[model samples]
Target: MAVASNYLLDTGPLSILCSFPLNASPYIYAILQYTKITLADSVIIEAGRGKIWRIVSPLFKTGEIESTTTPKEPEILDLSYGNDLGLGERSTIKSAMQMGLTAIIDDRDAFVVANRFAVHPIGFQDWMVMLSREVNLPTKMAIEIVRSSANQFPKMFLAHILKLLSE
Candidate 1:
């Protein structure tokens, strides 16, 4: 179960990750151990407006996460038509499409749009499960991360993942 060497992250996953302390930043580090992460520059600018910037900025500085300028292609803009997908989502999908990277997007609409564009996408929850199963991330830490990010997930799905971790 080899994960992609690099993944393009959208704002939702980035914001959820902000809950972790920058000093520790365990999950991001754990993920980094298995795969590289690239953020669209638009995500940095969009996330800068909130607490997410506090975490994303330092990781960028430390070289734990990389950033890329969004391509100004019309295809990137085309993904947003008739949808509420934001700049961050569009950029991530576009980057993933062009760069052969997986799009790490958690928003349902963005997930569907990414698929429509033939770009592979993984939700945060599935990403965590992969980390646990493939990367051997500790069950306790996986449970904690999932619990902390519960609001972003469906209740039944959360329960299922918790059960899987507990097994």
Candidate 2:
């Protein structure tokens, strides 16, 4: 489906955001301040693992993220039939479809399937670009954040995106 401007949070992106500046970046939460953001309890559960709850709670308290109820069983079942995905990813996709919001997921498998459901999927690098553009962040800073992230994605992947941004 076409990617809408608004978004729903998934575990991966949200987890990384929690490590960013706000103690919970959800960068879109900060970048798309004027846009509504949706989150399901499932994503919360996944994100809350470890010390993430400590960092993520305030964003909810301050109204940076809007919580969504669980998806109806039939809808969730229908989504599950074709793919094996986590509850958080499924819930994010369901919420995205129901709300017409983009699914802010970072997993390639889930992201590809989300598109088949006609919901747009946004990735971490996409937000990195958004922050870079919105704040006119120096290329160096963007590169630093990606390289320094605790996620430790991969050297080649980072190199590709950094090179793309440079070009």
User: What TM-score, computed on C-alpha atoms, does each candidate reach?
Assistant: 0.83, 0.74
Q: Scored by CA lDDT, what does every candidate get?
A: 0.76, 0.67
| Candidate 1 accuracy as lDDT | 0.76
lDDT of 1 by residue, 70-111 (tens): 877756355445368888888887788778887889888889
Q: Which ten residues in a row have the lowest lDDT in candidate 2?
A: 22-31
Q: List runs of model 1 lying over 4 Å from the truth.
A: 1-4, 20-34, 74-76, 79-83
lDDT score for candidate 2 against the true structure: 0.67
At residue 129, what lDDT does model 1 achieve?
77
Best by TM-score: 1
Q: Estimate, for each residue in 127-161, the C-alpha lDDT of model 2 and write its tens digit.
A: 56654655554566566666656354655577677
Error of 1 at 18 (Å): 1.0
